[model samples]
Target chain A: MDRAVFFISDHTGITAEALGRSLLSQFPDFRFERTTLPFVDTEVKLRAACQRIQASQRDSGQAPLVFSSLANAGLRTLLMASGAVVFDVFEGHIERLETALGLQSAQAVGRAHGFHAQGRERIEALKFALDTDDGLRADAYGAADIILVGVSRSGKTPACLYLSLQYGVAAANYPLAEEELERVELPRTLRAWRDKLFGLTLAPERLHLLREERRPGSRYAALPQCRREIQAAAALFQTAGIPCLDTSNMSVEEIATTVLHRSALKRLRW
Target chain B: MDRAVFFISDHTGITAEALGRSLLSQFPDFRFERTTLPFVDTEVKLRAACQRIQASQRDSGQAPLVFSSLANAGLRTLLMASGAVVFDVFEGHIERLETALGLQSAQAVGRAHGFHAQGRERIEALKFALDTDDGLRADAYGAADIILVGVSRSGKTPACLYLSLQYGVAAANYPLAEEELERVELPRTLRAWRDKLFGLTLAPERLHLLREERRPGSRYAALPQCRREIQAAAALFQTAGIPCLDTSNMSVEEIATTVLHRSALKRLRW
Candidate 1:
């Protein structure tokens, strides 16, 4: 039987989902039926959520788990009395935070994902990322916070976009073509910004599989071609003293974070 | 004086940052010096983080707040003894979850952002988003989970990319060109996928300002042009009975979540 879990929030519910999912990942043996209820800031919505939670509890004969990041104390109180196992995500920590800072919490709803000046910066970063994607505008590399260098399908585009959208980092990616890989030195266009460069490599088998999905039975997706490109790319990274990550078994989030860490680049927005 | 806050995790530190930022947003009056320490899985790295926290406490004469999601119990215990205000993100909730499920946690490290089968799905979704971005491939609409329709610079691309990267939802976006907006009807290609259409609109002034940044003094960036396009787009959405959201004051996360909520689409990955 799968347990029912709800992630409730007054805003976009992204934080609640993230926190709940991270905790639940610890218990991988159990299956969970998960739902996210965002923008639940009003009394009317609270009542509706309570009914759904209670019904789930009755249907399963088990108390449904509720993970909430409701900044409103009154709504959180109402939720706690709804016959569910409610975990107040902000409850235990806010008091400690207040004590530590010698101030009271504002308890405002929708503050986490609301519009702000930084939002515009994030948009600009996203534009920069798209405009510079796939080595389109290498001249714009002067303005980039970090530039990702990798062979095609080495997980560069997704990592660049994730870094930009999530942290407002101006990230651009350049794909090393076969001609560039055949040479022993870094591409001339990237030499000026070597300090801002980070490399991504993947296992040859994985690279071949990824390329095969896009271009089946083509020379580009051949195992030998992938192996040669990867070997050459690795040698280039070693020669250039560029820090690299093997993204064979990593997600976009992991690759982005590793790039930020290795390059010592600060996220423009949090 | 600004207080120091650390988001520590054995993995990417993204969950800790999200949870910490949400809690910190409650105290907007206070300025925070934030740092993220990711992949702190070893005792040596844990010791280094403790030193940074302790240094901040000593310098500011205030206990630095540490938001940690370290899955290893021993590392967490050591973090607690570091003489800072440590908020163990998973402690109070994990015990309750254990009690409810009658199972002990796996206590694994890097489980949240590690590679899994769903990671591949997310990558494929990202590729779909880019391939169909800005009406590049209308033929691909049949395969998308959702298609976002909006005028240029009305916040479609970022929303589509975020939806694809974060939730593994194959979101394709179509920019409503001047000809299509003037016609005051759905684009001919989009008629086949009306059920998957979601609309995004922005304030005319905001739209004009965004366009002006790209092409100064152009007719496309004029306020009258923006107003005309917006009014036509709104009427088209209304006549087509498609749900619309004004994205003038919303972030990309908010836009993506609202689209998922209004469309009743399930996130392919958590």
Candidate 2:
């Protein structure tokens, strides 16, 4: 059986879509027909959305589902009159929060994507990630939220970028150089910040494949070299008691999420 | 007046918040209290969300707005019974799309955030962004989807990074050197691929302030120098007819969106 789903909002409707996709994923047996009606701040657009929902309900013999983030009372009333199942994204809860916090929301549109303090902070974090990427700027450890230590091509750069990009985290990554690995001790620059360190390791085969793309036929890309480095990096992480995740089978999203959870890092508000 | 808003989902509820925030912002006269109930896959969680919504309605004398993307029919039914306004984000629309395309959705959960072919493509784009940043690999320009040209502190790096991180665009950026800027022409290497080039210009004052932070008191941070560079860059863009946007007073989101839209670049499905 097929049902219609609508994501209605005054802006991009990106948020509605994200939440809708997630919720809808749980029902693996049913098929959904999805459409987004963004920039629906006007009464006409709201009525159009209502018509679409009603048409779907009529055609399919099921109540059409609506995922809406509408903030206007008049529009909400208009949507409700459609007689389709509606999910109001913000109505009842905003009142509770306002009462509890003793403050009124700005009731402004696109504030989530607008330029503000948090957005500035995120931009700064991205610049920090770029500046401190790949073990650059050794003196800037004091400013880092967390530092990732790993061997070459073990997926340090993307992991750090993801943390900053997704969470406004000021992440720095250091490549464990061969000389430092031979000594089998944490680098002098990182010793003071060991508490802030997380390690990344990749499978030998994966590491070899990634390295070969960058410096093919070099010792760095050789399978044996990858194995030795992986072993050494793992030993360093274990001996130092630094929390680590194997990136061999993990996406950057998974790695960044795990690292943040393990580190107990607080994500900046979205 | 204050109202309650709920972002209900079986996953992160991020989308509900985004679309919800955007929609509510348009009605700046009304204040909203907000809550998010994610992972509402179980009947228990769904009921908990309902109780919260009902309680808010009881207290506030207004129904809470619900932005949901529930895929499961049973869960959707359970949520609808709460007597709150509901928005079915996927059900009504997926069927329409399936009908139009003559295919059924996979009906999988977490498809938006899950690792798939798109994920691999994004990863590759990110790697490309890192490799091609700051005009390091001119020989690899052919691999780029778009190449951003700008002077230092004109915001090319962050723009490229945003394109790759959010949209999976293989964006490369070139920082026009002082010598090249004096020449008042696109660099020899870039001329061949002029069509792929996009220019970024920053406000003189903003550029000056930004440059001063890195190279304090240097000529590059001087107002006159900043003005000169901005003029030269704008002139170059005009002569070459390369599309450009001012980075000053624009968030990275705004810049990236404009560039992608103006350039007719395709954003990968997230």
Which candidate wins on DockQ?
Answer: 1
- What are the DockQ scores of the candidates, in order? 0.66, 0.21
TM-score of chain A of each: 0.97, 0.78
- Model 1 chain B lowest lDDT segment of ten: B109-118
- Regions of model 1 farther than 4 Å from truth: A113-115, B113-115
DockQ category of candidate 1: medium
Q: Residue A222 of model 2: what lDDT?
A: 97
Taking the tens digit of each residue's C-alpha lDDT, what string does model 2 give over B159-178?
Answer: 88878876789999999888
Q: Candidate 2, after superposition: displacement of residue A224 in Å? A: 3.8
State interface RMSD in Å for all models: 2.1, 5.9
Instruction: Summing lDDT over every window of 10 consecutive residues in candidate 2 chain A, give the lowest-scoring window.
Output: A108-117
Clashing pairs in 1: none
Q: What lDDT would each prediction earn against the true structure?
A: 0.89, 0.76
Say which candidate scores most in TM-score: 1
Per-residue lDDT of A1-270 in model 1, one digit per residue for the tens?
A: 589999889988888888888888878877789988899999999999999999999899999999998998899999999989888888678888888888998888886732455787888898999999999899899899999999999999999999888889999999999999999699999999999899999999999998999899999999999999999999999999989999998888888998888788986545
RMSD of each: 1.3, 6.9
